[model samples]
Structure formats: C-alpha cells, structure tokens
Target chain A: MTLSITDVTKRYKIRVTRAQVNALNGVTIDLPAKKTLGIVGESGCGKSTLARMIVGLEQPSSGTVTWNGEPIFDKARNMLSSKHSNIQLVFQDPYSSLNPRQKIGDSIAEVLTVHHLVEKDAVQARIAELLTEVGISPELAHRYPHQLSGGQRQRVSIARALASQPDLLVLDEPVSALDVSVRAEVMNLLIDLRERLGLTYIFISHDLSMIRHISDQIAVMYLGKIVESGPWDSVLENPQHPYTKALIAAMPDHTEVGNNAYEAPLKGEVPDPASMPTGCAFHLRCPIAVPSCSTNAQTLREIEPNHQIACQEVK
Target chain B: MSKPLIEISNLTVSTTDDNRTLVNDVSFSIAPGEAVGVVGESGSGKTLTALSLLGLLPRGVHATSGSITYGGKDLLTADRETLRSIRGNEIAMIYQDPMTALNPVMKLGAQLIEVIQSHGGDTSNAMERVLTAFSEVGIPDPKRAYESYPHEFSGGMRQRVMIAMALILSPQLLIADEPTTALDVTIQQQILALVMQERRKRNMSMLWITHDLGVVANLVDRVIVMYAGRIVEVGSVKEVFTNPQHPYTAGLLASLPKASDKNRTRLLSIPGIPPKPWTVGESCAFSPRCSKADQQCRSSLPVLATNTHTDAACFHLMGDNS
Candidate 1:
C-alpha cells in the first residue's frame, strides 16, 4: 500500500476581493507503507492545504491523490469516499479541535460508531484500549476537554484519531501548541504508537528540529512549491536548495550557539501567494540567484539518487 | 562591574482577588550591555516578572513586594509621571505578536512617529528618523513600507517595525517577551540578528523572556531558569548550559530534541505537570515533578545556594557535585 500525490494544485478564492490565491502548485510525492514523510515550510507555504487535500477535507483544483491506487475523493458525489476513513488528520490546536461539551470517551466512541469499526457492545472497551494506547488514563474518559491539561487533551485527540483505526495519520504541527516539557512526551508517544501499530505518518511542521527527529523522508516547501525532497539525512546534512540551507542554518541549535560565526542566511519573508515573484518563487530572497533567475521557471529535478531540488543555480 | 543597569530584588506578584502568588521572591540583576534570558514553561511567571519592571501587570495582578531599581530609582514606587517619562525613553518593550502591539488602522510610519512624539522627541524630523530606523532593521523598501498599514506587512516585517519603534529612542534597556516565538525560524533569525545588532550599537541591556532553550543558548550571555513563580537556577550561559544544577533545569535541557544527537532516542521528559500557583506550598514547587525530589525537598523550601557553576535552589544538584 502506497500513497501518491501527483501534480496537485489548490487555489482559494477571496470572497470580498474576488481574487485567487494559488496555494499549492504542482506538488508530487510518493510515500511507501509505514514510512514517515515530513513536510516542512513557513506560514503561507501551502503545507496545510496539501494536508487537507490528502485527508479529503478539501479537493485539489487539479491532479490526483490516491491511497492504494484508489482516489480518496469521489468527484460525482462531491465528498470523500469510504476509503478516506483510513486517513485521519490531527490538527495543531488541541484546544479548539475537541468539542468543548463532549466527554473524552464519547468523542472517541463517536468515531468508532460512525465507522462501525466495532460492535455497539464493544465500544466502551475499545475506547479504553484507545486511551491506554496513547498513554492516557482510561478513567479520564468522563472528563470534559477543558478539564484536561493541554498535553492530555492532545492525547485524547490522538485517541479519537486512533478510534477510526487509521493507517496514515496526517499530524499538522501536533506538538507546536504544546509546552516544551510536554512536547517531548507527546512526541515519544507518537513514535511509540507508530512503531507498535505499523502506521505511516505525514508529519507537517515549521520546526526543522522536530522534523529531523521524526522523519524518514523530508520535503522542504516554499511559496506553493516543494523546493527540495530527499532522504532525511541527505536533505538535512547536505542540502542543495538555498531555501533548505537557509532553514537549516537559521535553526537555533545549542551545539552551534558557542560558535560566533553564525549568520542569518535568508534575507526576506515569503511573498504573497497571489502575487508570486516571476521565475523561481524564492529568487527574490535567494542569495545565489543570477539575473536569469528572474525569467526562468524552476521545477523539481533529480540532483542525485533519491534527492531532488528546484533551483536553476545549482549545477 | 560598572553599576548594574537594573536590579530586581525580592519581587512577589499576586492576584488582587484571591491573593494567589504568581511570582515569588524573584531576584536578579542585569549589567549594562548584558543580555539575560529568562526561560520557563507556561505559568512559570516569566512574563509577570518582566512586566513588573515596567508596572504593566494586568488589571487583576499586582506586585505586592518588590524593588525594581534602575539607576538608583525604584520603578515600583515611582509616580505615574516618573514612570511615563522612563517607560519609552529609558526602557522599551516588544511583545510576541506585533499585530496586537501595533495599531492596525494607522500607517506604519505615522505610528512610529507617534512613539517618537510621545517621548518628547523632535516631531519635525520624525519621518526621516522612522525611515532610518526601518532601514536599520533591514526592511527592504522603507519608502513603500512607511506608507503601508500594519496589515500590509508580513509577520517578519511587522516584527521589524515593532523593533524599530522600540529602539527609536536608543533606550538604555529593552525587555522582549517572546518577540520571535510567533515567527518562523528563517524570520526569527532575522529578528534576532536585527535586535542583537541594535543592542551592540547602543550598548543596551536586555531581558529576553522565552521558553526556547536554543534561543537562550544562541543569544543571551546569562540565563535565569524559573519554575512555578520562583527562580530555580541562575548563571552565565556557559556555566548553566554546560553544567545545569537544578533538576528542573536539567530536565528542561534534556527534553529538547537536539540536531547534534546522532541517536534519535526518547526524550527525558519531566514526569508530571506543573503545580497551580495556589497549590504551591512552602516546599519547592517543582518537587512534585522532579525526579530527584526527597523528603526535605517536599517538606521545606530551598533557597538559592552557590553551586560549583550556578546558584540553584535544589536539595539534589546535578553535574560536578552529583
């Protein structure tokens, strides 16, 4: 079973201004079973849009996203097909994701009931099993979302996602909203669960350190495009794209803190997607851009084995 | 060292309604041109400590006992007029979100000019000063940026504008509470560089409050670790990062996912949640979550004592002694 996203593009129309924003432009990726694919980018980089498309929450303007050679979206019905339940999305803010008035157990049981994953009589036992799998106490099932701490609430969210018995979990900045001490525990839980359940993950975050820690393959995105993609070690340690290099250099690592030779590599913020710069999307901020960069469009091309970059300057 | 730029002694902040202690007996000092980083998780009272220096505590919160002395003047006891004069002129602050800090309807340049005029600065040359400040912070098109509204600028540009406004007077001290936390790493580095450059140019002192240890390691000279409203550890960056004494501090540093680690092992997370402000008793507040907590740590409060590398409030210290 493999997940393939081929030439996907998403566009959003502004109601008041009637302007279109090109969120994702021609992004492609193939993830083998049980492998973690880390997608990283700054704000407005269209990572969230791609994640939404993959989970069938939103359909792409163009191209196809398939799981096990079956399209997740049903074009005729204008809704996600039955196979979409195999993929679940865990959002960034746990506080807003869970229903405020709902009990934690009921929230998980809702998924189980909707999917008909278990018998009605077995729903309570399944909820307890799900809670324990995520390292939450089964007794807290009666507690409301507000009664639980941020970390516990996130665990409940995970348990709710697990209640569907998903094979691929699209975690969108799962630990970003968490406190520093609690982030580690949640991350460890995710890693442990992934190993035990043989689950594949599409982890999305702006944090490169967290990405580096959890990812098997990594893709770096800029304005509406994947600038680089490769094995995690190769992409991180020996990056080809200037944007990828800038991100790695900009990360605040304690190991490099003692070295006073540090410098900010990137120059400017991400430009508006509606009015993207001509040629390379990153040419305006690229430190190594030539005059021709402004006129030449760049596309992802294999620079080495399993490594691809979208840049005209690199040999 | 030349007279300390700012000294905060025995500061205690609490709620007016319940009198629940938020910040307790926090004391530290920053020398001129030194950058000090205050690090802790949420509800650690790091922001309350910084806010007390400027008398900007929220409506329900009040500092009951503390002395925030700057240049021999206690800001806590100072009159409104005295504080008004000292606020933007001698001391400045920048927050995590520039959008909330800035006026959305006003043009960026006019807002900056307003800050200048409020500090009794020359209004005639205010536009030029604003443009110069914008360029100094590395805003690409200052003329266009000057005419734009706050909503027109990106998050990074908005932050640069905030820094420009804060440093227009070349204040002697700057207090930044998670100024770069809302930004991406690429933009965060730019803001950090810009602030450090301006600080060096003016020989300014700074108190940087953040939960990110990596930022503290990169930017600040000294660090103060806080937990449940009290200081847990204080020392130079080299001393503390190399040899953390307090268990909480050690746990925090260990919790981070380092790029340097060759093995991707499980993080050593601190066991339990932080205690509520009202629940904190006479004993060490971190005792409940601490792996090394003992009978003494739970029965009685520990005061900051000189360790080999840093001053830590812990019965069981790590590093050299351990």
Candidate 2:
C-alpha cells in the first residue's frame, strides 16, 4: 500500500482580486509501506498544503496524488470515499480538532460506524480498545475533550485517527504543541503504534530535532518547492542545499553555549509566496549565492546516491 | 564582587478563591549584566514569577508574600507611583505574542514615542530615539516602519519592533516572557541574537521565561528549573546540563528528541502529567513521575541542597544545606 505523489501543484485564486498564490509547486514524493517520510519548512512553506492534498481535503490544481497507482482525485469518484479507511490526517491543534461537546468514546465510535469498519455491537469495545492503545485510560473515554489535558486530548485525536484503520497517517505537527516530557510520550507511542500496526507516516513539522529523530527520509521545502530530499543521515549530516544548512546551523545546540559564539548562516524573512524571487526562492537569503542564481531557476537534481539538492552552486 | 541588581526572596503567589499557593517559596537573584532563564512546563508558575517582578499579574492572582528588591528597594511593597516610574524607565518587558502586545490602531512610531513620553523623558528627541532603536534592532528602513501600523509588520518584524520599544528608554533590566516561542527557527535565532547583542551593548540584566530547554541552554548564563510552582534545580547552564541532580530535570533533558539520536527510536519520557497546584501534597511534587522516588520522597518535601556547582531539591541527592 504505497502512496505516491507525482508533480502535484496547488494554487489558490484570491477572491475579489485577480491574483493567484501558488501554495505547492511541482512536488513529487513516494511513501513506501511502514516508513516515515518527514516534511519540514517554515510556516508558509506549503507543508500543510501538501498534507491537505494527500488527505483529500484539498485537490491539486494539476498533477496527481495516487494510492497504489490509482488517482485519488478523479472527479468521477467521490473524494476520500474509495480511500477513506486507508489514509487519515492527524491535525496540529488537538484543542480545536475534537468536537467540544462530544465524548471521546462517541467520537471514535462515530468514525468506526461511519466507515462501517466494525459491527454495531462491537463498536463500544473497539472504542475502549483504541483509547487504551494510545496510552489513555479506558475510563476517560467517557470524558469530554475539554476535561482532558493537552497531552491526553492529543492522544484522543490520535485514537480518532486510528479508528479508521488507516495504513498511512499524515500527522501534521502531532507533538509540537505538547510539553517536552509529554512530547516524548507521544513520540514513543507513535513509534510503538507504527511497529504494531505497520503504519506509514508523512510527519510534517517545523521542528528539526523531532524531524531528525523520527524520519527515515526527509524533504526540506522552501517557497512551495522542495529544495532538498534524501536519507535522514545524509541530509542532516552532509546537507547539500544552503537552506538545509542554514536550518541545521540555526538549531540550538546545548554544547555550543558559552563555548563559542552563535552563528546564523542566513537571515531575513522568507519571501512572499505570491511574489517569490526569481531563480531560487532562497537565493535572497543564501549566503553563497552567485551571480547566475538570480535568473537561473534550479530543480532537484541527484548529487549522490539517493541524495538530492536544488542549488546550482553545489558542484 | 559588585552588589546584586535584583533580589527576590521567598516569593509566593496565591489565588483569591481558596488562597491556594500557585508560586511557593520561590527565590532567586540576578546580577547586573547577567541573563537568567526560568524554564518550566505550563502551570509551573514561571510566567507568574516574571509578571510579579512588574506587578502585572492577571486577575484573580495576587502576591501574598515575597520581597522583590530592585536596587536595594522593595518593589512588592512600593506604592503604585513608584512602580509606574520604574516600569518603562529602569525596567522593561516584552511578551510572547507581539501582535497583541502592541496597539492595533496606533502607528508604530506613535506607540514607541508614547512609551518614551509616558516615562517623562524629553519628548522632543522621542522620534529620533525611536528610529535609532528600530535601526539598532535590525529593522530595515526604520523611517518607513515607523509610519506603518502593527498589522503591517510580519511576526518576526513585530517582535523586533517590541524589542525596539523595550530598549528605547535604556532600561537597566529587561524581562522577556517567552519572546521567541511564536517565531520560526531561523527567525528565533535572529531575535535571540539581537537580544543578546543588545544586552551586552547596554550592559543590562535580563530575566527570560521559556519552556524550551534547548533555547535556555544556548542563551542564558544561568538556569532555574521550576515544577509545581517550586524551584527544582538552579545552577549555571554547564553545571545543570552536564550533571542534573533532580530527577525531573533529568527527565526533561532525556525526553527531548535530540538531533544526535537519529538511530534511536524510543524516547525516554517521564510518565504522567505534572501535579496541579491544588492537588499538591506534603510530599515531593514529582514523586509520582520519578523512578528513583522512595518512601521518604513520597512523605516529605526537600529543601534545595547546594553543592559546588548546582542546587537541587531532592532528598536522595548528595549535598548539604544551601
């Protein structure tokens, strides 16, 4: 059950104006079964747009997103109907995602009953089992979302996602809102669940440490395009793109304090997606940008085995 | 050595409803030109501590006991007029969200100048001072940014504007409460660097409150770890990070998903949530989540014991009285 995204592009046309904003441009990736592919970028770098496209929440303006080589966005078939139980998305904010008035147990039961994943008589037992599997007490299944703490509410969100029996989970900033200790608990739970359920993940977060910790493969996005992608170690240890290097350099290292002065490789805000700079979107902030970088746009090119970078300066 | 700039002793905050203590017997100090980071999870009372320094705690919370001594004068007992004079002149603050912290209807220049004028400084030189501050904090084209409203600036830019506002008066101390939590990684680096640079340039002391240990490790000269409204550990950054005596501190460091641990999958997380202030008992507050806790730990609370390098509030630690 592989999920493949090929040359997917998404653009939003502004209302009351004759302007278009490109959210995701020419994105291509493959998610093999039971593997984690981490996507990281700044706030407006279109990571969420790609996640929305994959989950059938937003259709791409062009290109294709397929499951087992079948286009999931075909107009002939209902969106998310044929692939509802196979894929799911875990949202970033647990507080806003869950229904305020609904009990957590009923929430899970709704997904199960709506998808017809289980029989009516066994739904309550399945809800209790799902709640316990995500490290929440089965008794809390009766409590409302507000009654639970932030960590517990996030666990309930995960349980709701799991009730659909998804093979692939697109978790958007799953643990970013959690405290450090609670974040670890959630990450550990995800690791255990992935192994137990054989689930693939497209984990999206702006946190580099969490991405490096969980992802087998990583893709770095900038201005609606992927600038770098490769195996986790290769990309993190020997990053080829300037944007990736700047991100690595910007991550706070505990050992560097009082030992040496800090060095930020890049500065300045990311360009507006609507009016992105020509050539490389990161060229404006690239420390080593050359003369030709302003006019020559670069595409993802394989520099080494399985390592790709999209900068012309990298020989 | 020179005299300490600020001394807070036995600070305690309680709610008006039941008089339950939310910040209990907390004490720390900051020397001139030093930076201290207060780190804790939500409800650990770190934000309350920072707010108490300026007497701006939210409604329903009140400071019951403590002496906030600024330059050998008690601020907690000072009259409202004294606090008003010292607030923007001698001490300044920046909050977590700059968007809401700033006024929406006023121009950036008007807000910046208002802070200077309200402190009774020379109003004639206010515009010049605002532009100098804006440029100093790396706001490009300060002249243009001054005329724009708060909504016109980006998140990082608005935070820079907040920094400019805080430093315009040349305060001796700056209290930043989660200043960089809302920023992206690259922009957070920029803001941290800007703050540190300004701190050195002005020779000012700082009290930073945040939850990210990694940020605290890099930016602060000293660290104070709080839990359940009590100081769990206090030490220099090197001492605490290298050798954490408290189990809670160790749990926090271990729980982080480090970049170096790429090959490792399972994270070593401390089980259970932090105890609420209302649910706290006579025993150590962290005993429920601590693996090394014993009968004594669950029966009585421990005072902060001192060593050559660090101070920790744990009975099992090898240390004498502070």
Candidate 3:
C-alpha cells in the first residue's frame, strides 16, 4: 500500500503567550510500497512532527495524511481510525519508550493482546518468536528495562513495534541514542526486517552517514520545509540546496584529514519556528541568497527526472 | 617534543568505598600547543581520565595511584589552594552539556565576569572583555547575548557561550569533554572551527575527549583509543585512522557507516556490550568481545608495545608482520 502526506501542516499554540509555533509548513511526500524514505534535519526542523502525524499520534492542523486512499484519521471521532494501526513509530530514546516497571515480555504481550493478533494460549510462544526475530534471547523476556543494556532495550522496543505487524514503520532516530557499535547492530536488524517482511520505512535522523546507509530516497528538511528531495545518491553526491551541500560538507570524514580544513557553511543557527524568516525559510542562512530571495517564496521544482530542489539560486 | 605540556603516568582512579577501578593504569601526554583526541565508547573511562586531570573527579571517586605532572609540578598531589590558582587560570574545561555547566539564573555576561573576578583578573573593562570573548566565539550579537540567561539561548548558542567563557582567561590548556556531541552537525562544525581558531591564536594545548572517530580525525593531531579504562592504541591521526593496529580500533572504524562505501554492505559491529567497570579483570579487558582473543589473551594483560604504525596494547595486532 502507498502512504501519502499532502500539504500536512502542524502548529503548536503556546499556552501562555497564545502565539503559534509553526512546526510543519506544507510538508508533502509520497512513499510507495516497501520503499525506505529518509528524512534528515537538524533539531526543531519539524521532522519529528511529521513522523507523529504519519503515525496518527497527532492530526495535522490543515492537511491530510492518507493510507491506500483512505484518511488515517476519523473526522467524526476526532481521533485515529482502525486503519492507522498499519503504521507504527519507534522512538529515539529506548529507555524512556519502554515502561520501566513492566517486564519486556509483558510489554510485547500487551500489544499483541490489544491488537488480538495472536490467541491467548499462543501468546508466550509468539513472544519467544518475536524476541528471537530481533536477536534477543527469549530467556530475558522476564527482565525489566533497567536490567537490560541500551542495545537490548532498543531491540525490545522494536519487538513491541512489530507486534502490530505494521505495513509502515516510522523510525524517529531509532539508533541515535545508541553507541556506534550497537547502532550498527540495530541498523542491520532494520535492514534485515524490511527485507524479510516487505516493510515500508520512514527513517528520520540528523546523521547523514546513517541516512545514506539505509535510505532509497532522501529528503532534506530545514526550518519546517523540504529544501531537497531525490534519490539518495543524487541528493548526497551532487546536492542542490545550499543547506544540503553544507550538511554533506560538514559531515566528518576520517579519510579526508589534513586535506580539508573545517569550514562552517550556512552561518548562524536555525531560525525560530514561531517567527520564521519572510521569504525562503533558509534565506537567512543561505550563502548564495540574492536580494530578491528575502521576498520571494520558493517551492520544490523538478530539476531531473526524479530529483527536486527548492532553492532559487540553483539554476 | 618540546617539553610535554601535561604527562599522565600509571594513573588509576577508583571508587573509595568499593575500590572498583574506573580508570586503570591509563597514561598519555599532550605536548605544548598539540591537540590530542581521546576516543572511546560509553563506560570506557575516557571522561574519567580527563576529569582526573582537572582534579574534578566526582564524589567518592579518588585517584588511587598516579602522577599527573604539568610544567614539572604534580597536579594530583597539589594542594587545594594551588589547584584553585591553576584551575581556570592555567587550565580550563568545557563539558558536553553547557546548560548544566552554566548557572541558569545568572546572565551570561555576569557569569563570565564572575569567572574573571574570581580569578583575580583585572576588574577594569571587564564588560568589554566579556563582549569581546562573546564576539570571538561568533555569538552574532554579543551585547544582546550578554544579557540573556542560559535558558533563553538555544543549544548551539549556549555551547558558544561555554567556549567563550572557557577561553576568556586565555588558559594555556583546554580540556574539552564531548563539547560538540549534543550539537547539530552544522553547529558542531562552527564550534570546531572556533576552537581550532582560538587554539591556533593562543598556541594552546588541548585534550579533546569524544566517541566519534570522524570528529577526532578532523580536529586533532594525535589520537588515543581507550576501551575498558585502558589505552588500546596511540598514534598520529593519519597513522591510526589509515592503519589501525588494535583489533578494537579496527572494529570501531569498520563499524562506522562510510559515505564512500557505495556497496551498502552490512556494518561490522562488535559482538557484545562493553564490560562494566567492576567486571574488568587482570587480563585484557576487551578479550571477551574480541574475535582474536585466545587463552593467553584471557590469562594475562598486554602492555602498550610498538606496532607497524602505532603503539597498541594487543597480543594480536591487525596488520603487524614479524
């Protein structure tokens, strides 16, 4: 099944000041069946907000998110419909995501029981199978979150997500909290699972290296806008947007030592989401911005067959 | 090397009550104006080693035996008064989280002034110095940032403020413990550039501790790899990254997802989690997870020895001949 998010915008209203925080501004993307779409952005760029909207955790303020031509949210009930269960989200911090007091097996079992995916009698066996699928020992099912290491806790988180048998998995920085070695293990597991189960993935991370490893398609986000989108190789090797180029350049390469000096591209930090810059959201930090860039809004336009960029200066 | 700026020899730090060793027999030296990067994973004792240098070990943890000599004086044995004089004047430090390091209630400018005044620095034109330091670190608007509190600034700006405060005294040495780990890649590049600029301007020595090998390769001249509270490998950045001698170093390098690897092969991950501090024994601490470990490796510890391209503490070197 295909997942389409069209012009999804999310705004959070500040309680005290009554000011609106523009989290996601007109985010639009389409993911075909069993394809991996990677979203890369710095903090406060609305990547996570888009993930939440895709998984039906939060409804969009102004647009629609559909799965197989059906809206995921029910307008009458004002909540997620039954079809939303096809999408599951795995968070970055495994320790906070898993319940501290509950046993690992119990957490997985709770998901299975709520979804009624397995019978009551076969619950224990199903739990064992799930644990084994994620490379965890079935014997440790009784262990609490504190007793397991970070890697094991993350495996349990994955197992819980798989209990729903989702068609789409939105991984929000799944391995960012993990160490490098353990991050490899989790990433490998994800690649294996996607192949075996024919799963669609929407991976979000700030790390370009990790994104390049698993993504088939890539989207670069900046201040609640997608500035670049294309095949992973095209977007990474010959980046079009200035922000994307800076991100690729800033990525530390061990082999390039002594040859390249550290250059800070795209000066200054990301602007505040509440009071975004006038025209292009990145005009404030764009190194090649013209005077008209401050007044003209930019939209994604196809440069190549499948590659798209949103910058005005890149002819 | 022109008189090593700081030399640590046989340094061992342990918890006072349990006598559990956290950093065991770790030793390295940073020459004057040289930048050294200490690389390790969590619980690898890299931070503890850096902390011991500044005499900032947490409560209940004490250096059991070692000598941290700086400029012909043993800082480990120095008195409180001498340490107080040397702390922010001759040596400065910035941590991973600037929010916690800074006082949230105080204005950024006032806090920086306090650091100068507490060190008995010149009181005249203190505001000017603070603003100058702020501008040097690329605070955009030094005057506006000076009046802002820690909570008001973003993560990147706060780290710049921390770097500004750490460099305000123009210390001879700066010990940065994962200072850019929490920042975005773009902001991290900015901070690294700032640190490089300041270090070059002052000819200052630096001990940068981080888990990222890519960051180490980009920033530091020399690299020291630590695992389970011991130095696994030591060499120049080019030698270590190009030709790693230790198995752990090789595994760490292999585990990183390289952008140049167009094939998208599976990452080579280390088998198990790092051993807890108390579980490390007399034998090679990484033997349990190392694929090349033998009975001899499990029975005895290996000291640092010369290898092909670097000095490594391993019975089975990766590319060694003879």
Give the Cα-based TM-score of candidate 2 against the true structure: 0.97
Clashing pairs in 1: none
TM-scores for chain A, candidates in order? 0.96, 0.96, 0.96
Encode model 1's per-residue lDDT on A66-93: one tens digit a residue.
9889786653133333432788899999
Q: What class would a CAPRI assessor give candidate 1's docking? A: medium
- In model 2, what lDDT does residue B216 have? 74
Which parts of model 3 have CA positions greater than 4 angstroms off? A75-84, B320-322
Better of 2 and 3 by DockQ: 3
Comparison by lDDT, 2 against 3, better one: 3
Decide which is better by DockQ, 1 or 3.
3
lDDT (Cα, tens digit) per residue for candidate 3, span A1-315: 898889888899999988889999888898898999999999989999998888777888998999888786552133233332677899999999999999999999998887678889999999999999999999999999999989999999999999878889999999999987789999999999999999999999999999999999999999888999999999998899999999998898876765526778768889889888989989888899999999998999999978999988999
Tens digit per residue, CA lDDT, model 1, B45-157: 99999999888899999999979999789999998888888888999999999987899999999999999998899889889999999999999899998999998888888
Can you give the DockQ of every candidate in the order shown?
0.66, 0.68, 0.71
- Candidate 2, residues B112-221, lDDT tens digits: the string is 98998888989988899899999999999999999999999899999999999999889999999999898989999899889988988889999999998888787778
- TM agreement with the true structure for every prediction: 0.97, 0.97, 0.98
What interface-residue Cα RMSD does candidate 1 give after superposition? 1.5
